[model samples]
Target: MIETIYFAGGCFWGVEGYFQRIPGVVKTEVGYANGETENPTYEEVCYRNTGHSEAVKVDYDEDKILLIELLNKYYQIIDPYSLNKQGNDIGTQYRTGIYTSNDTQMKIAKNFLNKKQQKTDRKIQIEVKPIKNFCRAEEYHQNYLEKNPNGYCHINLNEANQYSKSHLTPIQYEVTQNNGTELPNTGKYNDFDNPGLYVDIVSGEPLFLSTDKFQSNCGWPAFSKPVEKLNEKIDTSAGMIRTEVRSRKADSHLGHVFNDGPGGSTRYCINSAALKFIPYDQLEKEGYGKYKKILASNF
Candidate 1:
């Protein structure tokens, strides 16, 4: 299913460019929103004292990306604490906001804001309200960054391509999406030992630690325990009872678990395609920096 959210983070040029690179984002259009006037133009909204903020209307597939995840990514670029500005662009038109059409999205948007408040000492100045009025920006403004490569953009586009960097192969998508199993002993981390963290392929949620990995000789990565328990349920299908592992955030189908493991451990035999490894050195860049100290202590 597809859902739409309007994000106003300073200039829509950079905001639209950022989300357009995301995998699940279906479409993006620059526009003016929550203004008093109807059919507000770029000139009127920017200089004529219109209340509209430069915004980007983002449409995305919910199956591929969660609203919470997208909201988190959006916050990475903007100075939510700053009022009526982002970088050198100082004006009310560049104010940050999250405009939604319905009550459900409004709740999620506010919840995201509340969590963000706990992280910083500075007050969040971004607005969260129901969109009262909206109109598309001019044709040239729709994809300003794409058309003019050297456009004025405050945010780095790399922030939005983190998930794209872990691009999946055909087989990986088949296993994670279709719930298929990889052939035994052929997995990448089956016998490999490295001090790092493993994350979900789709949502990038941390799943396992190298410290918990044990040599069960099971042909796949054998984990004595996950970093934390995954949101999975027991599977009793095809007349076979097994504890199936699944990514709760991304809803991707991982592998199953078994009791026959080393050290009297409950083995979690997971598929390589369902996971992406973040090396100890790159953990900080991958947003799992907290685990670096954990790996160091274990080492």
Candidate 2:
């Protein structure tokens, strides 16, 4: 299905750059969203008084890039706890927000916000509103990073590049590094015979197993739960639509989490780029200490 997300996090340029580099984002355009005017201009938005926030509009494939994953990335670069400020950039236009296009986006946005609130001890000031009109930014704003690798922007490539240093294969680099996505049902794991835990592709963190996977018919891998700590703060972001899931450790693209799953379930549909699986028989041989206990308990 076609999905859009609008995220605002101070200085649309940097936020745009960050999202443009992620996988599953079909298109990335810097724009002005959630405002009163019919079509607010860049200069008008600069005043930070048109009720507009400098935001990024992201066109993504839901099957490839989950909303939860995008939101998490939005939080990584900007401080959610702070109000209308990201590092040096500060203004009403720089404020955080999630502008929805329809009832489904609205519902998912609210549910995500609620989950975020419960996890954080601080109060949330993120604005979740219906999108009014989205005006695309000047042509120079599009692919700012690609045009000039060392251009002036808020995001630090060193921080992002650190995650890219995981020795990913050529295809992994093309997708994760270039913001491209693997076609649905074309990944190696989709039809693998190996059955066991899937570790983090970059960090090798034990995340999911074949047994825990359930067919969501969503053309992606879905798991009931994550192997990591549940309270991890997945950030909320506003863009072409609003997205909510991003990983900080590897900075690699991860899938989204949702309350809706098959068989009355909660599914965390993840990207294969973010994981590496360990077959059940190879668990002990791979020096996994005692993961045999996980297999033993099942029987």
lDDT of 2 by residue, 64-175 (tens): 5578777766666777787888768778888889888778888888888898889989977788888777888888887676565567787764444443454577666655
> What's the TM for model 1?
0.57
> Over 4 Å off in model 1, which ranges?
166-299
C-alpha lDDT score of every prediction, in listed order: 0.83, 0.68
Best by lDDT: 1
Query: Model 2 segments beyond 4 Å from truth?
Result: 157-299
TM-score (C-alpha, index-matched) for candidate 2? 0.55
Cα lDDT tens digits, model 1, 49-134, are 98999999988878678898889888899998899999888999999999996899999999999998998898999899998788
Task: Pick the TM-score winner.
Answer: 1
